[model samples]
Target: MLTPSKVLDLYFLEARCMLIEVAATLDRFDRAVDSDTNGDGGDDRIEKLYESLQVLSSKSETPDRSEQLLKLFSGPA
Candidate 1:
């Protein structure tokens, strides 16, 4: 039986590996685009994807319980 910490560690390791693969794939795509003369909207889309991933990977400051409750009741801004 895995402990909670062990499970969390496994999950984190998997996530790290996946993120590394995504970054590498993105890098290759960017290089291919650079070699091509045709300008598609792929660059913009890739940039947005990268930004979103960065946001997802970042740690956010936790709100207090009162703030969390207020948001829960008020719904998203």
Candidate 2:
């Protein structure tokens, strides 16, 4: 059976992997935005996503649970 710490470790690894995947996906969207020139409001949305990803990628000295929860629930900004 997995200990609590082990479970938490697994979850942490999973979260990191998920963040990497999201960053990759954002990169793809960024490339698409660069190529497309229709300018049909997609740029705004992509910009927001990129900003959020940047926040996620930031290395904080301490884990801000409240801020993370707020961002998770509030959905951008």
Question: Which candidate number has the best lDDT?
Answer: 2
- RMSD per candidate (Å) reads 7.4, 4.6
TM-score against truth, every candidate: 0.55, 0.50
Q: Over the stretch 1-77, how does candidate 1's per-residue lDDT look in tens digits?
A: 88989988879889789879988988888798788787753745575565656556556586254444344445357
lDDT of 2 at 46: 64
- Taken over the whole model, the C-alpha lDDT of each candidate is 0.67, 0.71
Off by over 4 Å in 1: 1-4, 41-43, 62-77
| lDDT at position 62, candidate 1 | 64
